[model samples]
Target: MTKPDLAKRPDDVSSMFDRVSRGYDLTNDVLSLGVTPYWRMRARRAIDPHPGQQVLDVACGTGTVTRILADHGSTVTGLDFSHGMIEEAIKRHGDHPNITFQQGDATQLPFDDNTFDVTTVSFGIRNVQEPKRALAEMLRVTKPGGKILVCEFSHPTNGLVNFGYDTYMNVLMPGIVKLVSSDPEAYDYLFNTIQAWPEQATFASWLREVGYEQVAHRNLTYGIVALHRGTKPAA
Candidate 1:
């Protein structure tokens, strides 16, 4: 099956997520075998969240990455376009004074320029209708000299592993998602989207094209996931 073009108009993008909001996290964990949390841990370490820094966690479904950033002493504002997802994140993480959950579109953020010390997104960029535009917004909100960090899925370069990984994601993962979620095809689209996502180097170059400096990327778990980072230029 061909991958769905996730980069589309706002209305189409919004509707896809509204349907998946109920089972996004559960399907993610099942597909990743509960290792998505560890992937986020590596992303948190790479970003080096610090005290007094304000961070934005874009597409912060269920506040997974938001809570991690908060635990590292950074003030985190988690945003998602899906109202149900944002409400879930708020219910889960909003009690903490350091973490705020809100509904916002990635292509059009609500904050002013350089409003945050760091901006991060986990497993969300691929779903954005305009990834380049969304990345630009991330750069816009991040102060000069701060970080724009990302953690997302990527296919393996190793041929043998790629074959096995594809089998698992396309076959077994969907079965599991079906068991856990009524929205079974939503996870299927996730598999499709990740497979269609650009390579790690391609994404890093996209960040550079969006005006991010010091861009770097590291593949984790044999290339099933990748963590990328870019820093805003200091004046």
Candidate 2:
């Protein structure tokens, strides 16, 4: 299926993900050189979820992050705008006792204010139509003093690393995707979005603008990806 240029069309992004849902995980693993698991582990540790806490994993593609949170004893709600992705997530982890999957938008979350102890989005925030609105919604739905974490691709600080990463994303990634991905164009869209996303420092500033405190980011893999965390200010 020919997908709209997702960077321009916010509504089309979900459908693009839906079409790629079946092979998403496998293609991602291949393209990331099997390092995504390491990234997710670092992101999970950043959250440090506790038993009995209510957590929301926004844009929780295929439940990878959701499962991590649930495994740590948090009552996790995995929310994604893509129904196909949600279906895949349920099929993979439905039997997990603490995880529930929901189809919902990031910019306009379907939850009450202050409903969760932690709100997280992994590699999904950049796809949102209005990231600031999404961040505000994350803050609104999280309890005061609760944490918000965003894990997303970022620019590499090292010149050589940046050049190599750019070549991989622009040149080699598409070839690998064509071999393994159901929708190869989706990977092209992925590369475009990653290129367009803000760097670590700018994203941390966005977190603070949305009323989060202690906004900070930890770069992983030489700044190829960043894990950002902030706390909803206690009133």
Candidate 3:
């Protein structure tokens, strides 16, 4: 499920998200059965960002994880290609000086080599047309020994669970999205991408191949969600 080399490029996906930005978070909460926030908290746990540390959250749609990580004591910069999402993030969290939202690309992050103490991308990598390139950028910005945390909807292993989740995402969620956002088709695409995401083993191997060492993953909620973690070695 590598997405068939999507004709929609990275910028196209970004634009699609921007168009649906207003209702995006709400849609996630409803569609995922209010578990998306719990997933974010778990992703932060995987990264284990510390006080006074600098962390970057890529594809930070409305900065849920960004603000959460900031509150945990790290100075966080939330980057997204969608201006609308960034605007919403600022509108919601601008009162916190530790959290800053900016417009940036995931595959081509606007940061120097080895700059961040940690980096995290929650439910974002699947939207990138070039996921490997974004992963490389994430590794490039992470300081030696720093962790890269990724939370994604990995394809379920259990047949029964997968069937139920797919029913929710593919069958039930579309109707919900239609009422929530004008671009219901975008949410449909999102569901399709989730189904098409690479399995956990392949993704962990990909992370190691991209130069992230100590790769590991943990399943959540009966394989409906997963958190993958890796670290760059100090030279």
Candidate 4:
């Protein structure tokens, strides 16, 4: 039941993810109330992966979104800080010719500058100790004019929906996680982080501040989740 604190120390967060890797995907599916697939679909659509593109899926737990990008014809690399998560990803997707998994840090990506046509992270950026550093790294790796997308839990815009979502996260989700998650304390960390995360507009501003252009966000499920996109300046 290891759990990372709000400060999000890299070692503790990585170990926490490792502890939950065995049932990570399943638990996420359950916790997301079966909307995980829809979220992935929205993310894929936003990315619009195609042949001849080099796509990087950062913190790609279990390689789920990475596999989707590969299916759409991109050569995809799924990178995660958690070795256990990377192991699970390889176990599930090693046979895919278009996909590769690597264990790496987000703040300092392993690849060279201008290496990827598109870089994305879904439900992972918030776990980074310095989210802006990761965003900058993603920008550095992306080709000029390339795309960057992040899909994460976000604050709801509508007051009524916000209240309901808050109620669910603060009240209902704890009991549900205790029942289904192997490491319930990890999910407790998840809840806390989600609660503390910046809103969609604020996070989009972070992307802009990190040198991404054309930054925008689309709210989903009444803003319980937000998909943010940006482009590396061509010049």
Estimated TM-score for each candidate: 0.93, 0.96, 0.94, 0.98
RMSD of each: 2.5, 1.3, 2.8, 1.1
Scored against the true structure, residue 124 in model 1 reaches a CA lDDT of 88
Each prediction's total of clashing residue pairs, residues at least 3 apart in sequence or on different chains, is 0, 0, 0, 0
lDDT of 2 by residue, 45-94 (tens): 99887798999999998998999899999999999999899999999998
Model 1 pairs in collision: none
lDDT of 1 by residue, 1-235 (tens): 3224455455665566677776777777776888987898899898788889899999887788899889989999999888778877777778998998888899999999989988999988988878999999999888889888889898687899899898887678777877888666566667668878999889999999999999998889888898898999996
Counting only residues 3 or more apart in sequence or on different chains, how many pairs clash (N, Cα, C under 3 Å) in candidate 2?
Answer: 0
List the lowest-lDDT window of 10 residues for candidate 4. Answer: 1-10
TM-score computed on alpha carbons, candidate 3: 0.94
Worst 10 residues of 3 by lDDT: 1-10
Candidate 3 ranges with C-alpha deviation above 4 Å: 1-5
* Per-residue lDDT of candidate 3, residues 70-100 (tens digit): 8888999999998888888888897897887
Clashing pairs in 2: none
By the lDDT metric, which is better: model 2 or model 3?
2
| Rank list by TM-score | 4, 2, 3, 1
Best by lDDT: 4
Model 4 quality (TM-score):
0.98
Global CA lDDT computed for model 1: 0.84
Candidate 2 regions with alpha-carbon error over 4 angstroms:
6-8
